[model samples]
Target: MCRHVVPASASRKALLLQALLLISAGMVGTWCVQAITIETVNKASEVMCVRYWIPNEVGGGCNEVRMGNKWDIQVTDRWKAATVWATEGGCGGAHCNTGPPTGVTQFEITVDGGWSNDYYDISALAGFNLGLTVAPTNPTCASQICTSLSTCQGVVPGGPDRTKACKYGSASYVLTFIK
Candidate 1:
């Protein structure tokens, strides 16, 4: 009679490979859930208002985020899309300035699925009031920074070109105002 024994390391590697295969084949009974965080860092000279909304859903109204302050949005599971804006003044009442000249910084994100590719971008089409940067926690992903109207996209006379897509198990984004 002949018998064979497998090394512990080899056995562990085989188990890992089987798990990955199961996950990819959707045979595992668990769904992939990704945690996403969007943090805003205000580095401007004055107080700035930040607003975010998902399409077809009621959104958070403009709120003041003072210099050196931060605002955060946390989401779990899958989200279709969200748009965030950084503006100069408050909404309604006496402030109510949500347009250009002072400019408005726009950031958009879309997470299709935990196993699917996610997308993000910074647009100055609305205007370029403040310098903007989008930094992803995943170093394998790319970062986008637009410090001027000329260097940004979505503006008139130019086509959209600042979008990026990546697959991250857990995603974290930091939006910084560089002005």
Candidate 2:
């Protein structure tokens, strides 16, 4: 009878240890989740390279999986805007360099995605951004795409600010990036 009692006592002790271990794990997981929220904030900034697929012509919108070149640009009017912004994930996600920074002509916020997402307009969007501009997705001259692309295709993933230019066209695709 004494041996039986000793075994049962040990089992209860083991069970208590296991319970404590599980509770500690749950607490650590909770802390980690909270940390992520804060981390993402620190990670996000205004100036970043925005990846885009600009059509070669205005009449035609570009949508190939090609990576576009990125530039350094600003996104602030003052105050919150004054802080430098930085980001990666550009050029079809290949040229993701947030090291120095990047630039663009202008920016806009489009609600087409039902999320009021910000997008930058490209000069090429004029043809597509207009009330009506229709054409196939290819340029007349495949080699000389951007040159002869006058009104051929108007695309926007960036702008020079409202004062510099107002490119008001509903963008079909634009990826807003932040560091």
Candidate 3:
């Protein structure tokens, strides 16, 4: 029986081709995890209650954000949506809810997972308890801001208006709660 051997040049070429294919298929060099940092700022005159959670997970409950302070949530390479609420009162209060209910301001964000673009929006459809603004670090991405309850769009029966999107791994965001 005779044994067959591959030449060094041919082996290298084959390996290079395999690598290129993997990269193109988004398998090789795709482990570069990108993150979007969402900074929630409390510009209200009093302490604000905040709650946040990703899809299929329960939030840690209402956390108080002191006036002029900020809370940051970093979303890494995950294909889930993160929802945050800023309310005048804590959870179980007259003004807040564990979920996005009426009278609670909500900010929803879906970070890029290397395959799709990032989407973000501020919704007053639940009724406005606080003014909200979602500003992305990328200038190319537009900001979603609603500063007045009367001027703010109410429930559209579906979703928020003026949803903004940015390139994958492009920008972090700042969600500000104004007075």
Which ten residues in a row are the worst by lDDT in model 1? 93-102
Model 1 TM-score (2 dp): 0.67
Cα-based TM-score, every candidate: 0.67, 0.17, 0.70
Compared with the true structure, all predictions reach lDDT values of 0.68, 0.25, 0.70
Tell me the lDDT of candidate 1.
0.68
In model 3, residue pairs whose N, Cα or C atoms come closer than 3 Å (at least 3 residues apart or on different chains), thus clashing, are none
- Please provide, for model 3 over 1-179, each residue's C-alpha lDDT reduced to its tens digit, 9 standing for 90 to 100: 12345566787779878778988888854354676677889997577778776766543345678888988876675636667877774444543334565777788777763347887777666677878877889899887767886655332234545656788788888988987
lDDT of 1 by residue, 86-149 (tens): 7664443533232222257677777753456677788766666878888888888878877887
Position 61, candidate 2: lDDT: 14
Better of 1 and 2 by TM-score: 1
For model 3 the local lDDT of residue 152 reads 51
- Evaluate residue 21 in candidate 3 and report its C-alpha lDDT on the 0 to 100 scale: 92
1 versus 3: better TM-score goes to: 3
Which wins on lDDT, candidate 1 or candidate 3? 3
- lDDT, candidate 2, 63-137, per-residue tens: 112123233232211111111122333234343222212342222222111232222223333222111121211
Q: Indicate the worst ten consecutive residues by lDDT in candidate 3.
A: 152-161
Highest-scoring model, TM-score: 3
Considering every candidate listed, which one attains the maximal lDDT? Answer: 3
